[model samples]
Target: MKFDCLIVDDEMELAETTCEYFNLFDVHTAFVTSAEACREFLREHEVSLLLLDINLGGTSGFQLCKELRLTTSIPILFISARSSEDDVLIALDIGGDDYIHKPYTLRVLLAKVKAVLKRWSNEPIPEEDGGLLQAGPVQIDTKLRRATLNGEPLKLKTMEYKLLHYLVQHKNRVIPKEELFSGVWGDIFAGDGTLNVHIRHLREKIEVSPKEPQLICTVWGIGYAFEGE
Candidate 1:
């Protein structure tokens, strides 16, 4: 079975409530109360996105996310009461696409989920020209929505691909953080930490020395510029 979203939360009441809310909005949703249950559910079902809680009984969502990333590129949004910056950073660092704090309004959560679903959908973005964008050693096939570094395929998450494509499209120009948030994430509310983590991830993939990135250069307080010859 295919589900639009799955809530993997040990808080059964909250998970079921959120699931009901999503289903009310026509987002076919399901819930599992433990990390083991989530794993089992995934084995038998296809889920487009995950609303995962950090504290999942015996196993942490962070561990599950790390395990999932090893095989799947599906979007994972962390939903937790832990609001510390470190928690958020760790979530994004380990393959969680976005973090949502607890006590979140249902309407807002729904909007965020829909936006992610839209971005991660199979529908390709409208291509420019022949849709092949090159930046130094990196080449992006926009139509196929994949990128390669030195002719080798890059294992980029959905947001990483979008961010890289946006940077390459405007190569040599220093794009401000605000512009990146609006253009790539399509969310003005996206934090700087999220952008920073993704930028670092991209640099690690395309730059020979991530510490001193040549392809994606940081402009300090400004933004980033993709300088491709």
Candidate 2:
């Protein structure tokens, strides 16, 4: 069976409530109380998005996210009470699509989830010339939402792919932080820590050495520029 959304939370009451609320609005949602249950559920069903909590009793949601990344690119939104910037950064860095602080209103969360699904269903932005985008050793198939390095496939999550696609599309120009945030994430409120971590992950995938990246260069006081050979 295919589910539109799955809420993986140790807070059973909150998870159940969220699931019921989403289903009430025709969202087709489900809930699981632990990371193990989440894994088991995925094995048996198809899920479009995940509402994950940071702490899952004995199992860490971050670990589960990392593990899932090895196989699937399902969008994950972290919903937790941990409001620390460090926690948010870690969540985004480790493949989370978005992070929502706890004590959230059900309506707002449902709207956000619907918005994400809608965005996922939309067609990828195409190049002016049209066709595959090749720069340096990286090649992006916009239609497929996939990127390859040196002809090898890269396992990029949704946000990572969006960031890379935007950067590569506008290569050789220094893009300001605010512009990249708004352009790629569609939100100017996205934190620098979140952007920085995503950039590091991108560097690790495309650069010969993440310590000395040659493609995506930083402008120190400003932002980043993609200088492809």
Candidate 3:
């Protein structure tokens, strides 16, 4: 299977150049000039990662990152001319996995992309795959990527599935946010809120009550764990 990436930058020259670089590395990247183009491309195709710029046509890439995070859990790498510390924090805070300032080395950019993709690759859900990984009444299929509680399937998104899978695989252990981010989301460098959102969503689905999460438990400033009998 070909790993695909979408580059959303209004800088047509730089976008094409980067596209060429990715092609050289067999990353199979495609370029879009605007956020609308990105929306359209993603609707029809599966993307492994996103190379986004903060200034795209008149819209901020950070805004688009949050919007994308609402639906998909694709890895987001921010490449922009804005090198301010505040800008970097804001980008990572809003679901961006990597922050790259402009005038960057093409080799460095390529390396970062490769590193992120190697770390986090979401597998496709398979059929005839229900083998319940049960802890209490909550069950998750290790292969099929589905979770059930009280015999009802939980419609988990990509990120939620990953979080649940990792926690369940390491059941009874407290997983640090850094480890979770690296293992599940791919460690290009993502935001805390990204993990929080997915964790909140998973609790809502797997736990009987999101307010009092039973399945996905938090460990204060540490991270989260999946505990069951």
Model 3's alpha-carbon lDDT is 0.79
By lDDT, who's the top model here? 1
Model 2, residue 26: displacement in angstroms? 3.2
lDDT of 2: 0.87
**After best superposition, candidate 2 residue 154: deviation in angstroms?**
6.2
Compared with the true structure, what per-residue lDDT tens digits does model 3 show for residues 192-212?
A: 655776786677777778999
Off by over 4 Å in 3: 1-3, 12-26, 35-48, 58-112, 119-130, 186-188
> Compared with the true structure, what per-residue lDDT tens digits does model 1 show for residues 1-229?
9999999999999999999999999999999999999999999999999999999888999999999999898989999999999999999999888888998999899988887787677466669859899979889998889899889999987788999999998999999999998788776656687898999888888889999888899999999999996
**TM-score leaderboard ranking:** 1, 2, 3
Best by TM-score: 1
How far does residue 199 in candidate 3 sit from its true spot (Å)? Answer: 0.8
* Local lDDT at 170 for model 2: 86
Clash list (residue pairs), candidate 2: none
lDDT of each: 0.90, 0.87, 0.79
By TM-score, the better pick of 1 and 2 is 1
Collision count for each candidate, in order = 0, 0, 1
lDDT of 1 at 209: 94
The segments of candidate 1 whose C-alpha lies over 4 angstroms from its true place after superposition are 143-155, 186-189, 219-222
